[model samples]
Target: MASPVKLYVYDLSNGIARQMSLQLTGRQIDGIWHTSVVVFGKEIFYGQGISITNPGRSHHGRPLQIIDMGETALDEQTFTEYLHEIRQHYTADKYHLLDFNCNSFTNDCVGFLTGGSIPAWIKDLPTDFLSTPFGAALRPTIDAMYRRPTPGQIPAPSPRDPQSASSLLQSVANRAAGSSSTNGYLPTPAATPLQATASVASPLQLCTNPHTLNSLFRTHRAVTVFFTSQTCPPCKMVEPVFERLAEDKASEGVAFAKVDMGVGLGGEVARAWNVRVTPTFLFFLDGNKVHELKGVDAPELRTQVDLLIYQAFPPHPHTSLNLSSIRSISLDPILFPQVPAFQTAQSKLDGFIDASSSMDAKQKAKCKQTLASPVIPFLQSRFATKINPNIPQSRVHAVCSEWNKVTATLVDALPTAELFPIVDMWRLAILDEAVANWCATGSASGSSPIHMLLDKAVSAIASSDTTAVPRNFLLTTLRMLANGFSHVTLARTLIDGRSAATPNKTASTRQNLTSVLVATLLHTDAPVRTAAASVAFNVAAHCQKPLIDAQRNGRRGVSVKIDDAEGDWEVEMVSAVVEAIGRETQSEDVVHRLTASLAFILHLSPYYEVQLKPLLDVLQARVILLAKWKGGNGGLGEQGLSKKDVRRLVEEVARNLCP
Candidate 1:
């Protein structure tokens, strides 16, 4: 089901910016815009990091504009997972007012949910403000105010002004009605004293001693020093330029520093570097001075800074490719959240508990008691509605608590083979956010019930023949794992191999997941194949999301370093998925997902040419896909390879593997 998405737009200045922007920034700005994506009863915004609150309940209060961003096809669970994945990139420390702020987050979220962007005026306000001369002059002060700190704080909105949307609107109307009385003039807001700067050293450092300068050179990959004198007119002209460049290149591993030649120890440092003139720029690479430029030539200085960055950090070859199609791939994790009939699931599980000879009388009684608990009834009513905006969160926690207790008892007493029904019930319950979070984070003792249950299933599959494992049990396990992606923590636990209970069992968890994944991908049942494809797609999406984000950042001349742990399973997963693709000639949906997974693991991947490339070539992946493309329905009528979207995806994967 689709949910309507709304963009709540607030002005940081409340009503002050509209009135006083021209006087302050010399521009007729509407307001200092702030935006949040309001959907699923949550106002998701980025400020002190990505946060969620009841709609219109944030500290920013009511929005000045409520733009309808249309609808999102994602259900609450899937969308929550998407947010969990994206939250890593939008941390509090990474927030920037001009570059990556609240509006930036809204734009990204709106694009993900509705495939649309926020209105241009709200997003372009920063650029417009910076274009003005006054705004340009105030850029340093603005950066200092918004820059990340050991203890950074965005100034609180004024309490003297009413915070409600209606009150703010009324004040604006009152001002508009009385415009003629004051010749259309509005009072400028009183200036507040600037707060102390951040405890963390700025990228634009000030060095008064050789030791400090030498330490900076050793720490950063590339360093640029601006040697200036207070008495030099050219030095004054370029100081602001140097500071702006420092702000821009700070994230790129290049440090910028200013040395005042007329200040303490400045003369000694100048002579140490053999600087003959003020406004001299010295470029250092790997702690060695590589290039020098003199005078206040701003354009040349900019060029030299970029050149030094390039020399220190060469561009990844994948960044140069026009792989827009790959970049356009959806980063949303595929989840299977179908809830089964509670009565039916309970009856089936009771049958298993009754038939189990391994279970003693006490165990059987306890299991049946758990089945009769309020947890099942609560879940039945919880997912009864398509979108229950008013579902009591307290009720959710209560049900989750009951289930957690029962799960711990069942896992200890019952056999692994008979626990599919219990696992299935937990999977259905996980559709609720509270249950998902509980299962993801695990118990207070730091044990993951979901991980343990899934591990037992994997072991069962591994020990028994594929044909011997019950079809329903295998399907239930696959679906259970797929639904585990609902919470970001569980998603990480599954992919990154970090077990809550056994942190050292990282390799075991990863191997168990892959073992089950690879086994199920080739299962005889069509439903099992479909379920496996969804699981594969989720893992593949996880693998490629960081790479895709890096590619996007690269386009903006900023590089985001992905963790090595992110790609640890890429090569192995790709091999398993490609082999599954060759075998998946039956289901169109399965084939499409498999090919999409292949494209994801291959596209913009750092190991493409080095590792995955050779493996794909050896597998004859291009030939295999080409055969599928040619054989199916005369290239258009085939089931798996005939559809336009499927054909396009296969072609993309084939092209990626082309020698």
Candidate 2:
């Protein structure tokens, strides 16, 4: 159930700033604004860092005002997950008093929860204060008070530091009654124990204490430590090299840490590890000390680190191949961006609407009105212009509403065979982000007009035995689904049943978009098969992005994010693309696209070894792709790739499978 989200507004000055602000700053400021988002029985705020407390029970006491910020559709678990991701950006060290304080945090939360911001007064208070001469004069002093050390160049906040910002902020707001700091993170609600949030761990961690170092050892499979002292000149020389190597290995389930033997609890750690020397390196594999070295040797360091990575993640067999061509190939998705002429598409659609005896008089009138002013004009003006014409949001909303109404009515009135013209028009319109996001939201809830229409087309194909579904209908539907990937939200929806409207955990790819794309991969028509290949490529690209990003950032292993939400669809998609490629012999375009999609699905993918490799071997992907590459020997009937580039690509894919 959706719960009400409220903004708990507090006057940090306890009304003193309101009365004294005119004299102090020469401006009539109402109050020193501090805000917390109150939602799901938790009062969430960011000061030293993101903190959750029982509503209205934090040190701030009663709120000056509680503003209703409408209901949040995000369930507690999802919201908690969002908090986990967002907290990285709101760490205690990143906090600023005049900028990015409690109010900034609340603004982001309100925007996510309700698609609106915290009131202008609360959000604009910092700007209002900074505008006055007195405030401008105080900016430097305030900034200096909140300045943080350069990131990754210092030790973690020492537990012994009693004057932490969280305590200081609390004391200042509470009139200096007392001070307290207890790690800044309190227990979250029991109902949603999101202890494990999806966030990239910092490449370099400063180990000020044994506790932090132990935590790293517990969580990571491999941990690399650089032990140094302030007095060690060699430590300074090798610091940059260690940091760089840490960044390169960070994403490979390796945690890199640095400890200063002379500072805080670092002395205890050094003594415990029996490291009497400065600039020592210790490598731990699975919490056990595996190797130790004492030196500033860069080459040896690099060698040992590479050896550690190899032990952690064995290289894929495909990595041993000598295919320079495949490595050079771009993994970017092949998107269908050609927008068919809007007028002709609309004209074709209008004929269907006019001829539909099933469409009511009121429905026909609504469709015509929608097309004349908003829908057709919006598309023509938006796409025709070289420069983006700054169309107002009101007009965008009008187009979205009208498009939804007309499309929903048409889907109901027109038969599946006659739906191609309208579906084609939709394929073009969804290239716009706003319309695509709307359609994605509707798809998640099973209410979108485009979603409903695509379902009808898929149903027609399923019910038919032989080429009964119209070719145009299949082509248009596949193209529309391909265009759905133009926006990230819609792409995720099409790939894994995730949408902006709701988080449907039970959402699967066995049916819906995946089923349609898999079935149409071997469609009788070449154009339909090509279009299906495009859709399959988009899906592969979505799954491939994180893995590629990890590898590019110098991480090891293909990433399986949050345990692979699509379940068995990764195997299903690869199997379908391999089957489709084997049968496609007519169009070079089809083979090239199908080959690209297959390569993307297989490249740097975790599914390859455990699932896809066996499947590829069983299906004899090597033979099929090689047949395309080699062609019939000496004027045989076999049609081989005529394009050198396509043949090279096919050879590369085949070599990886059977090399």
| Candidate number with greatest lDDT | 2
Q: Mark the regions of model 1 whose C-alpha exceeds 4 Å error after superposition.
A: 1-233, 250-290, 311-316, 319-324, 357-362, 386-395, 443-446, 500-508, 553-568, 632-640
lDDT of 2 at 307: 78
How well is each residue in 189-208 modelled by candidate 1, as lDDT tens digits?
23331121121224565555
Q: What's each prediction's TM-score?
A: 0.64, 0.64
Considering summed lDDT, which 10 consecutive residues are worst modelled in model 1?
177-186
Candidate 2 displacement at residue 19 in angstroms: 35
Q: Name every residue pair that clashes in candidate 1.
A: none
Worst window of 10 by summed lDDT in candidate 2: 192-201
Model 2: runs farther than 4 Å from truth? Answer: 1-202, 206-219, 225-253, 258-304, 339-344, 354-359, 384-388, 437-450, 499-505, 509-511, 549-558, 562-567, 633-639
